[model samples]
Target: MSDRNGNPQDPDNGPESPHRLIEARLQKMAELGESVELYPYGFDRSHTSEQMRADEKSLTEAETKVRYPGRIMAKRGTGKTLFVPVQDERGTVQAYFRKDDLGDEAFHRVQKLMDIGDWVGVEGKLFRTRTGELSIHVEDFTFLSKAIRPLPEKYHDMSLENRCRRRYLDLAMNQESRERFRRRSEIIAEIRAFFAEEEFLEVETPVLQSLYGGATARPFKTHHNALDMTLYLRIADELYLKRLIVGGLEKVYEIAKDFRNEGMDRTHNPEFTMLECYAAYWDYHDMMDLMERLMRRLARGISADGKLKYGEVELDFSQPFGRIRFMDALQDKTGRDLMAADDEEVAAVAREHGITLKKGMGRDKILDELFSELVEPGLVQPTFVMDHPKELSPLAKAHRETEGLVERFEMFVAGFELSNSFSELNDPREQRERFVAQKALLEAGDEEAQQLDEDFLQAMEQGMPPTGGMGIGIDRLVMLLVDSNNIRDVLLFPHMRPEQS
Candidate 1:
């Protein structure tokens, strides 16, 4: 007779079970408050359970008898016998149970209570089922945890809205979501390795600053009681990282959590991860080369090829990234050179394009608005739009060839800006002037203008080496690499409005 409790058969008080048919027999459990408890307290970790179930075909003869513990993903067939698909984190395997083997009472238990999604451990011999599926034939079994709620039916309708809202359910059922995350991990690993090989010292910067002066973006402010002052969450790590360069760290990088008080869209997030790096003695040109190589490495690992197919666009990372001048791109699209265009002419062009160029809107802001509305959406390939007007790029050094433009380049892929690099300004005087100009702009109602970071200026006074700094939106890059159009798909948990209480 089969021992349900794995104990000697009793006659008089033999299994004081309910009078009703034992349609389902729970296996002897090692968990606390469970049947014939063998463990001391919590039994979350199954001691005898195999670390990872090996494929039967790949396993040695001795390994074929391995017992595995996992959740039941699916169940089919019943009556005198049952077939259940058990899934551990690594993979899934089928488990078979029979009425004759489990005996009368045990067989009934299997029928009623052995529901899908319950965690169970089975000590079984590996063999091929008559259906040609590799399966485990139970010698003995144990209950791990009983899942109270039933999982969604595998054949149930799955909608995009439902998938995003109930991500846990989607994760349990959708293989695509699982694989995307797996690739995300690999991509991060490859990026870290690449940075390490380049001798870039990864450093952490302050998240909450007394004065937020990094990038030109609105800041989320909060109060600190002990200090009795308002603190602003960092929008970028540029200012702080550059300060480190002044303090003698030649090459430094920060994989920072930057918070932007901005609109949430398909490509924008309020809080995001960015890989910002600064290298001494490197210019924007050199930075672009490094960036291309890093991107190629990431694409190679993500797809195991130098190309990634993203939304009808096959982006080939192997080929040399194309370079285009910002003004030339403008001239190409607008039939007028930016340098030759007066304020009136620029405003006329803006009006023609239905772009609202406000009163006292400087040439730079007009150009920026025009670029966003017209030029940006057109850049679908891996193209670098270089030599931005000086007013548009505050931190970048003045261009060598142009009179009023900066040596900066923004790389776009699949119509999204992936990376922004610049020949960083090393002149303290010029840098301070730029900050003063920005402060004036801020005072004149341009809240998104860069702030005057006195500490950063002081660092510049101490002499920072000529540097090339770059910031890459990791989420955007991941989206491109994974061929995901929606930014939320790349992010594990995106910000959502609180539900009504």
Candidate 2:
């Protein structure tokens, strides 16, 4: 059924649904118009549920002094007494109402005005119930805000798609959802604290860029009306952070939101958070140690034992992380030396693994697909896959010991790439050649190609020190740490397709 506004309604709840409940609530507001201000300015809450619980033993049950506010989540009893679970940010407590204490007229008025989703401030004293539940005995109550529309039904109309689209409902109804987001916030704070202690300057980079480079991914594009030039949402923070390195900022990091014109999956999102860090005079080896320490710290910070369970896989961060050269690991998985393989041989490997690439994608791209299919999943524990092909790492410095590889390491965990680091490419001429090669790939139909940003090249020419730069997908890391299955599970506002009308 359609509403008066021409919006779709749930077929299962034709009339006695959220729509009818909202209509009933609107009528209640109309009836109580002259008697109450349903939407009050504010409530001066003296104690949160947590504070009340902390002082649970000190406060007298007979005395009434505390002013507490929370949303009425659940209600019980239809007679002269009512028990409702009131939830604040920290936790929930029960509010006990008696008609004798409030009188019949006021009590009946409350029954008329209050609903499960309404916010209320209670003037009450802490007490222990007959069942020993910590609760509040109300002397007086004030309506804070009326929830005109009821919450989604517990079992119906609360699908995953609906939850993502209407996160407010999900958060209100699901405590796990609320706590997961809180954990996300706390994890981020811990990261900032860690960086600060290590003396890395937390910095912000431009989200809107004239040219996007630093990653092999397409960027979201826009045009600025005032400037009248095209602007692309940044896909990586590596280039700008390296520019700061050129400016002689020894250590810099940015916790940034990067936008990518990409596919969405359980692990991938179009828009995501990234923690990019760069330090001068450090190589990928140093970065490997830093990442391992950071991960160990973060894992222990969230998990008490530095061990985590993601799905059925148990990851012990307390153990030393495994490391392997990228090409060697691929050869072990494929039983062929991919580096020595010709185009036809590599194409055969790709076909064997059920991999399909864009028509003109480079050999390295094909190799990456094959590894992603065969090797990435078995890298269940924390593992460093090091020294990728120079063709694959356009921004990484060439491997000093190897002929055609770059000093790069990608950290993988729980079947996903968690972080990537490089001994940043600093030679201006070499960097130019790398960009030229990437341009050739771009023209050959590889859409995820780096653009030659002259401005950045000039920064490099002015002299950038030997620097190690790393980018960690904050969402993906949060997922592994929190055991959240989907990218949307960790993100409060994950990108979603529009609801069908």
| Best lDDT among the predictions, by candidate number | 2
Winning model by TM-score: 2
Question: Model 1, range 188-295, lDDT digits (tens) per residue?
Answer: 778888999999999999999988876889999999999899999999999999998888898899887899999998898899989999999999999999998998
Candidate 1, overall lDDT? 0.79
Q: What TM-score does candidate 2 get on C-alpha atoms?
A: 0.93
Positional deviation of residue 54's Cα in model 1 after best superposition, in angstroms: 7.1
Q: Please, what are the lDDT tens digits per residue for candidate 2 over residues 1-501?
A: 133233546433344555666778878777766677888999999888888888887775446478989898988865989888888878888899999899987787677668889898988888989998878899999888888878767655578877887899888888788899999999999889988988899999899999998998988999999999999999998889999999999999999899999989988889899999999999999999989888999999867889999899889998889999989999998899988888899998888878876676568778888878889989999999999987889999999998888999999998889999999999999999999988887887777989988999999999999999999999999998889889999999899875444
RMSD to the hidden true structure, all candidates: 8.4, 3.0
Candidate 2 Cα misplacement greater than 4 A, ranges: 1-19, 60-64, 155-157, 342-344, 348-358
